[model samples]
Target chain A: MTVVIGFEGSANKIGIGIIRDGEVLSNPRRTYITPPGEGFQPSDTARHHRSVILTVLKEALEQAGLKSSDIDCVAYTKGPGMGAPLVTVALVARTVAQLWGKPLVGVNHCIGHIEMGRLITKANNPTVLYVSGGNTQVIAYSERRYRIFGETIDIAVGNCLDRFARVIKISNDPSPGYNIEQMAKKGSQYVELPYTVKGMDVSFSGILSYIEEAANKMLGSRQCTAEDLCFSLQETVFAMLVEITERAMAHCSSQEVLIVGGVGCNLRLQEMMGVMCKERGAKLFATDERFCIDNGAMIAQAGWEMFRSGQVTELEDSWITQRYRTDEVEVTWRD
Target chain B: MTVLKRLGRRRLPIANKMAVPENDDQASKLEFSLDVPFPSARQAAVALGSLSPDREPRRGGVHKRLTLTGSVLNVKWRADEARVLRVSVNSFLDHLSLVLETMHAFSADVCEDPHVVLGHQPPSAT
Candidate 1:
């Protein structure tokens, strides 16, 4: 019975998760919400993370009802995130590992999502669609690696939605993306938008730019409502995601499709992917808001897999990297 | 002498260095020091090892060096401007605070002088 504690502050959210084998004893998180018309900056996000990281860690421990001695491994998101926020969490993880005298496992953020999804949904082998504010990729495992079959050529799908959210000046109380998703529910009109899907790769920047201009011209002119704009944007971007995901499913010839990331909580995206899965005689696996959004539990789950496979990060190699790729980590834990 | 209870942050602008603008128009000539206290020399060295890596986002504009003096972790920084110095120092403080708190929380288990901390200096560095 291996117990692991993981830290995640790679983005706007800072979370701590404690896992004992396949069971999550506790997972607590805090998100920094920015005002409307503004996005979170690296420094400000790190400050927010620093302020509550310890409290969250304490809460995680209390919730899990576990002491420091119970934990066998310390895990943290190592990369593929903002530099400042990534370092903020990695620093704490390193210090804690030293104090607790446990082995440190530096986890890749995307792999954390995939591993967590697998654990929660019990999807033995599935093609993964990883879409978050920071990344968008369709991945499949082959020969000891979660190879990237397709990815964003420009901006991520969630970034496109978030930038459009700012254009609309929507509330970021919970999240700009969540607000947009709610607004899209009320939208009836489907204003035409650009659809850019090149082969297996997808691009969202051009679509975002076009919609930004269209929203400005149309919103002030009383032609397009914010809801309609949101609906149009979601339909376009999610359609692009479904297209590439389905293509990856075909390429991998897999029977299951798993959606993992902050944006994976979107019902519309899941519904769309579900339809594709149904048509292809495939099963769709996705988690709710609790698991879909960035959390320390995901990192811990990924680290648990690696640690059980006899992998641990040395103190000298625990520094965070902003651009670590998904395919960089060898999936030693997998068959 | 009263030892600092918490890590103290101090920034000094080198007027002489600023008078010449060492490298091009913007040379990070500002410097700051952060002295973080730990329960043991071993823990102080652990903090140094944990933070020594990780290069700054912008090279040449900012530089950081971590050294250990017994039970205190001494961090020195050099930067091109007050803004640059503030950014780097702010980040360092965040890391240092976490280290101190974690050490304090787990104080019961850590043994004294268990491992040799790599970056150790004489008390003169203080």
Candidate 2:
């Protein structure tokens, strides 16, 4: 059994996961929750990760019940994330690999999400919609690369939701997007928000700006409740995403559609995608919070695949890349 | 096991060597020094390799150096102002704590000496 230990701190969530082959041995994570009306900064998020990462690592090893000798590889998210938090994780991953005498693999955070989704959902060669606070893209596997068919030209769909949550003074206890989903569920009215989907690419900054002003003015004048605003926002942006994803699905002409990212767990988005998948005669594969959110198991799972294909990152070349893209990696593990 | 001599473009002799050339000036007066104790010398070196890769691109007002003597990691920082000094020190401590905790976990189960892992042979085995 090939065993891999993964470290992930690309965002506010810091997770350590141990995986043996296709099975998850252990996955433990801690999120740096901020107060309402505020978002986490890079330095603050990094400090938080530095504090809890080792504790989570201890828990991961304890739960896995694997000796150091059993581990075959060490994996870490090499980024497309905040600089400081990414560095914190890379620092630990580098040191631990040295200490444990294992080979290191630098994993792309987006590919981590995709691989974990595929492993958990068993969706083979599906058109993937990866939406997170930092990224939004519709991807398909073609010719040894996950080619980006469509993506956001401005802010990501999840970032729009998060910034709108801040505008409404929503609690970030669990997550801003999760809270917004709950609020949207209670919403009765469908307020109109700008829908800006240009060809295959989508933009959300204009929508976010419009909604921020609308929420402030409407809340002040009781034009509509925050729930209504949330519902409107979800409906509008998810439609934009669904439109582009469906366009990608049409282009790829694939039968399966997989949703993978922090925002992929949103019931509304999943439900919306499900409708589109059903209409297009395709399948929708998604995971719950455990696998969907930024977690270490995803990284380990991806690393396991990479290492199995003879991919090993020399420690000196394992720098944390803040803008590592999804299409840059060669998918050696896949057909 | 690779030592990081290329934090910048240049190379150093040691595996875990990264140094910014010393600049002594009146403006660079704010200085701080810290000694972080680890269980072993190799662990300190691992900490050094782990933490020192984040060299600045001259955007900040801080300059720093990391060196390992025995099991203690020596950190000396010279910044242009007190604010820069404080920020640099705090960031260093945060990284140091992470390294220490990682050591606490793996140092017991894994061989304390990293060369053993790299060489794939215990000293006794050799």
| Top candidate by DockQ | 1
lDDT tens digits by residue: candidate 1, A106-178: 9999999999999999999999999999899999999999999999999988889888888889988798889
Candidate 2 local lDDT, B16-74, one digit each (tens): 22233455554436666766554446766888878876775377977889888886678
- Candidate 1, residue A79: how far the Cα is off, in Å: 0.7
lDDT tens digits, residue span B1-126, model 1? 112233232212111222324565555266677666654577677778678767777564888888877777777777767888777776666666666666555554444435533222334453
Taking all chains together, each candidate's TM-score versus the true structure is 0.89, 0.87
Error of 1 at B76 (Å): 4.0
The candidate 1 chain A region of ten consecutive residues with least summed lDDT is A92-101
Off by over 4 Å in 1: B1-39, B78-86, B105-126
lDDT of 2 at A140: 96
